[model samples]
Target: MNVNPVELHEVSFAYNGTEVLRQVTLTVRPGEFLAVIGPNGGGKTTLLKIILGLLRPSEGTVTVLGTDPVSARAQIGYVPQRSAHERDFPISVWDTVLMGRLGRRAFRLSYHSDDEDAAREALRAVEMLDYQDRQIGRLSEGQRQRVFVARALAGRPRLLLMDEPTASVDVVMQAGIYQLLQKIKQDLTIVLVTHDIGVIASYVDKIACLGGEMFYHDSKEIGQKDLEKMYDCPVELIAHGVPHRVVREHRHD
Candidate 1:
C-alpha cells in the first residue's frame, strides 16, 4: 500500500474574502519528486505557504505526514524562493548551517558529535564543505543557495520542499542545482515548484500543474489533447528527443 506524505482535501484560502485557492485537492506520495508548475499569481507561493504551515487554510484540511502541517513542521526541511531571503545578512556559513541543529540540541544542553557530523555531511552533500568556514555574504548566488540547502539538510528532514530552487542562479548554475537535487532525492522526498518547462520533461517523476483548478498527470508523457485541456491554451511542441512545449501567452480579444 502506498502512503501519501501530504494530502489536501477541499483546501481553500483567501485574503480579505478574495479566494486564492479554490478547494485544491492534492496528494504527494513518499519518495516522489513532484513539480507544481503554474504561472505567477496563480497561488503557487500561497499553496506552498499553506503546506509549510505559515498560513492556515480558510476552509478544509491539509494533512502532512498524517498530521497537520503546523504540528509536524519541524519534520520538514524548506528551501524558500531565492528572492524570499535577504542574502546580505551578516552570517558565517558554519553558523548558518548549525542552526538546523537547534531541533536536536533540546535533547542535550550542548552540541554533540552527531549534530556536528550531520552539518558537515549536509555541506558535503551539496559539495560546499570547503566554504563552510567562509561568510555567506562573500559567496556567489549559486554558492549561497547551496549553503541554504545545507542548512535544511542538517535537520535530516523526511520531506524537503523548495519554492523556485533555481530562481536567482545563472543558467549554468541552475543546471548544477538540478543535478545536486537529484543526488539528494535518494534519501529524502523532494517537492519543488517551478515554471521552467525545459527540464520537467526530464527531471521530475510527475508533473502536477495548477492553473484555475489542478491537473495531476501520472505520466509526464501524454497525449497532446489532454495537455491542451489542462493548460486551456495552445501549446507548441519543440521536438528534440525530450518533448518541449512552447506555451504562448494568451491575449484578451
Candidate 2:
C-alpha cells in the first residue's frame, strides 16, 4: 500500500516562548504537488523545518513517509531559501551537487562511483551538466537555483521540499523554473513554500494557505475567504487580468 508522503496532526511549534504555529494539521499524499503560501513570519519556514526533522514540534505528532521525520529524512530532499552570501561561495557546481550524497555512502573517505553517477544524472536532469565544472559563484541566479535543485535531486529523494526557490530570479526565469518542476513532478512529490501566488495555480496540484493555522480547501482553488483568513486582511488577488481566480477581488459598495 502507498503511504502518505507527509502527515502532521495538531502540530504546534514555539520559539523563545513565542508560538509560531498552533495546532496545524496537514497531509500530503503521494505524487502531490502542494504549495504553502502565507505572509512573512507566519511559520511557513518553521513548518518546513519541522517536516524535515530539523526542528521538533512543541506539541502533536509529525510523520513523513509512514515514519518519523528524522527516520525518513534519507528519502527527503530539501532546497532551503537562498542566502545572499551563498552566491559568492567558492565551490564548483559538481562539488556542490555531490554534497547531497554525503551521508548516504558506505565509507566517508571519498565519494564512490555511485555518488558520481547520481550527481551526474541530477545535473543532467536540471540541464546543468555542461556547467558542472564551472564555479558556482559565476552562474546567474536562475542557473544557481537550478544547480541547487540538482543538488537536492542528487540525493534521489522521493519527497522534495523547496523553500522560496525562485525568490531572486526574474519573471521569465521564474516561469522557467516552474516549467522544470513540471517535468519532474511526475516522479517526485513536491511541497513548496512560495509567495508567488500568481503562478502557483498553473503549476501546483493543491494549495495550502498557512498562517498560525492551516486553511486548506483540499483543492488547487482557494476561495477569497481562505485568503483573507490566511493574511488576516482583505486580499485582492488581481493578476493583471489573469483568468485564474485564486482569490477574488474585494469590491466596495
Candidate 3:
C-alpha cells in the first residue's frame, strides 16, 4: 500500500518554554500540492523543519515518506527562501544544481555520469539548461529562482518543500514560478510555506492555515471566518488580480 508523503500527528513544538506550534496534525498525499500560509511568527517554517528532521517536536509524532525523517532524507528536497547573498555568489548554475545530488546518496568526492544526467534533466525541467554554464550571479532574480528549484529537483525527491519560492520576484515572475510548479506538481508532492494567499488558490490543491494551530478541512476552499481566525482580521481573498470567493460571499459587516 502507498503511504502519505508527510504525516504529523498532534505535533507540538516549543522554544525556551514558549509554545510555537500546538497539536498540529497534517497529512500530505502523493502528488498533492499543499500550501501553508499564515502570519509571520506562526511557525510555518518551524513546521517544515520538523518534517525535515532539523527540529524535533516537543510533543507528538512525525513521519515523512512512511519512515523517520532522517532515514527518509534522500526522498525529500528543500528550497529555502532566496537570499541576496546567493544572487552574488560566484558560482556557475551547473555546479549549483549538481550540489543537489549530495543529499540523495552517500558522499562522493566527485559527481558521476548519473549525477550529471540528473542535474541536466532538472535544469531542463526548469528550462534553465541553456544557462548551465553561466554565472548564477548574472541571472535575473526569476531565473535564479528557477535555478534554485532545479537544484531541488536534481535530487529526484518524491516530496518537495519550498519556503516562499517567489519572495524575491515581482508579481509576474511569481506567477511564472507558480505556473512552473503547476506543471511539475503532477509528479511530486509539494508542501509550500508562503504568504501569497491570493495566487496560491489558482495553483495548489489544498491549503493549511497555521498559527500555533492548524485550521484545515482538507480542501482548498477556505471561508472568510477561517481567514479571519488565521490572520486575525477580515480578509478579502484575491485570485487572478480580482476578488475571488474561496468559499462564500464576502459579508459587508
Candidate 4:
C-alpha cells in the first residue's frame, strides 16, 4: 500500500489569543492533485505553512511524507504566494531556478553540473527552457509563474505546494498553468491553494473547502449548501463548460 504524502490530524492554529484553524484534518494521497479553496484569511496559507514546517500548529499532529514537516521539508517543493525579491530585478530564469538546489548543498561554493542538469530538466518540464536565458522581469506574469514552478521542480520533490500561483497571471494564462500542473501531478502529489474556484475544478482531483473549518471531498461535486457553510453566506456555483465558478450572493443588511 502507498503511504499518504500529507496527513493532518485535528490540526489547529492560533495567533496571540485568536484562533485561525479549528480541528482541521486532511489527507493527501500520493500523486493526488488537491485544491484548497477558501475566502481570504480562511487559513489556507496557514495550512500550507504548516505543511512546509514554517509554522507549527497550536494543537494536533501534522505529518508529511510519514515524517514531521520540518524533517521532511527538504523533500517538498514550495511556491509561495509572492516572490521575495523585486520582479523587475535583472535575474536570468536559469539562475532563479538554480537557486532551488541550494537546499541540497551544505555551502554556497558553486553549482555543480548535476544542479544545472536538474534546473534545465525542470525548465523543460514547464516549457520554459527556451526562456532560460531571458531575464525573469522581461517575461509576462504567466511565464514568470511557470518559471517559479520550474524553480520548485528543480528540487525534485515528491510533493509540490503552490500558494495562489496564478493570482498574478492573466485569465487566459491561468488555464495553461493548470494544464501544466495536471501534467506534472502524474509524477508527484500537489497541494494548491487558490480562490479561483471556477478554473480549478477541471484540473484538480479533489477539493478541500476551508474556512475556519474544512470540508473535503473526493471530487469537485460540492453542494451549494456546503459552499454556503464554508463561506458563511449564500453561494451559487456557475458552470461554464468544464469549469465552475462560485459566486457569493450579496445581502444588504
Candidate 5:
C-alpha cells in the first residue's frame, strides 16, 4: 500500500482555554496539491502547526510520512506567511537560501560544496540564480517571495507546507508563484493555506474548507451547499476563464 504523506485522525487544538480546531481529520496523498481556505481566526495556521509538530494537538493523532511529525520534520520544508527579517537587514539572496542547509550540516562554521551546489540549483529552479549576490532588501516583493521558495527548495524536502505565499504579491506575481508550485508538485506533496479561493481552484488538486470545523473535498469544484455550510452563510461562486469569484450573500432581514 502507498503511504500517505500526512494523516491527522480526529485532531483538535486549543489556546489558553479557547478552542481552535475540533475533531479535524485529514489525509494527504503523495504528489497531491491541497489548498486550505478559511476566514481569519479559523484555525488554518494552527492545523499546519500541528502537522509540522511545532505544536502538539490537544487530542487525536498526527503523522507525517508514516512517522510522528516531530521525527519526520527533517524531510519537510515550510514557507511561513511572512518573513521575520527587516527589509534593511544585510543579507544576500544566496546566503538566505544557504540557511536551509544548516540543518543537515554537522558544524555551522562553513558550508560544504554539496551545500553550495544545492543552494545554486534551488535558486536556478526559481529563476533567482542571477540575483544570488544581490541583497534581499533590494528585490521586489515578488522576487523576494521567489527567493524564499528557493530557500525551502534547498532542503530537497519530500513534503512542503506554505502559508499565504502570495499574500503580498501582485496578481501577475501570484499566478507566477502558483505556476511554479504546479511544476514542483510533480515530485512532492504540498499543502497551502490561503484565503484566495478563486485563484487556488485552478491550481490545487483538492480543497479543505476550515472554520471551527473542517470540510474536505476531492475536487476544487465545491458545491453551493458545501460553501454555505463551510462559511455559515449563503455563498456564490462565479467563474470567468481561469479567474473566479466567491461572494457572500447578505440577508436583508
Candidate 6:
C-alpha cells in the first residue's frame, strides 16, 4: 500500500475562541494535485500553515512524510503568492531559484554539479532558464511567478504547497500559469489554495471545496449542483475537459 504523503488527524484550530477547523481529518496520496477551494476566513491558509509547521493544531496531530512538519520541513517546498513589486530588494532570478536549494546548500555553501544541474532543469521546466540574470524586480508578474515556482522546484520537493499563485497576474497570465502548474503537477504532489474555480478545471486532480464546512469532492462530475451546494447560489457548468468548472453570478467566493 502506498503511504499518504500528508495526514491530518482530528485537527482543530481557532483564533481567540472562533473555531477555524474543527475535527478536520484529511489525507493526501503521493503525487496528487489536491486544490483547496473555499470562501474567505474558511481556514484554507490555516490548513496549509498547519501542514507546513507554521501553525500547530489546537486539537490534533499532523504527520507529513511520517514525521511532524518541523522535523520534515526539508521534504516540502512552498511557493507563497505575494507580489514582488516592492522596491529596493535586490534579487536575481538565478539567485531566487538558488534559494530553494539553500537547505542542502547551507551545508555546502558552494553548489555542487548536481545542484547546478537541478536548478537548470527546474528553470527550463518553467521556461525561464534564459532569463536567469534578470533582476526579479524587472520581470513581469507572470515571469516573477514562474521564478518563484522555479525556486520551489529547486527544493526537489516530494510535496509542494502553493497559495493563489495567479491572483496577482492578469487573465492572460493566469491561463499560462495554470498550464505551467499542470506540467509541474506531474512531478510532485501539489496542494494549491485558489479562488478561481474556472481556471482549475483543466489541471488539478481533485477539488476540495471548503465552505461553511470542508468538503472534498471529485473533480470529475462537478456540475451546477455540486457548485450550488458549495457556494449556495445558482451556477452554470462549463466543460473544457476533465476539469469542469462552474459559472455563477459570483464565481470566486
Query: TM-score for each prediction?
Result: 0.86, 0.94, 0.93, 0.92, 0.91, 0.87
Across 163-188, the per-residue lDDT of candidate 2 in tens digits comes to 99889899899989989998988879
Choose the strongest candidate by TM-score. 2
Residue 128 Cα positional deviation in candidate 4, in Å, after optimal superposition: 1.0
lDDT of model 1 at position 166: 79
Residues 80-180, candidate 3: write the lDDT tens digits: 88778887788999999998998755566778899999999999999999999999999999999999999999999999999988886898999899999
The residue-level lDDT of candidate 5 at 80 comes to 81
> Model 4, residue 154: what's the lDDT?
94
Please count the clashing residue pairs in each candidate, in the order shown: 0, 0, 0, 1, 0, 1
Q: What lDDT tens digits, residue by residue, belong to model 6 across residues 137-228?
A: 88898998898888889888888999888877898998898899888777588888876666666667777866535666655445455466
Worst 10 residues of 4 by lDDT: 238-247
lDDT of 2 at 21: 95
lDDT of each: 0.78, 0.88, 0.87, 0.87, 0.85, 0.79
Clashing pairs in 2: none
Decide which is better by lDDT, 2 or 6. Answer: 2
- The collision pairs in model 3 are none
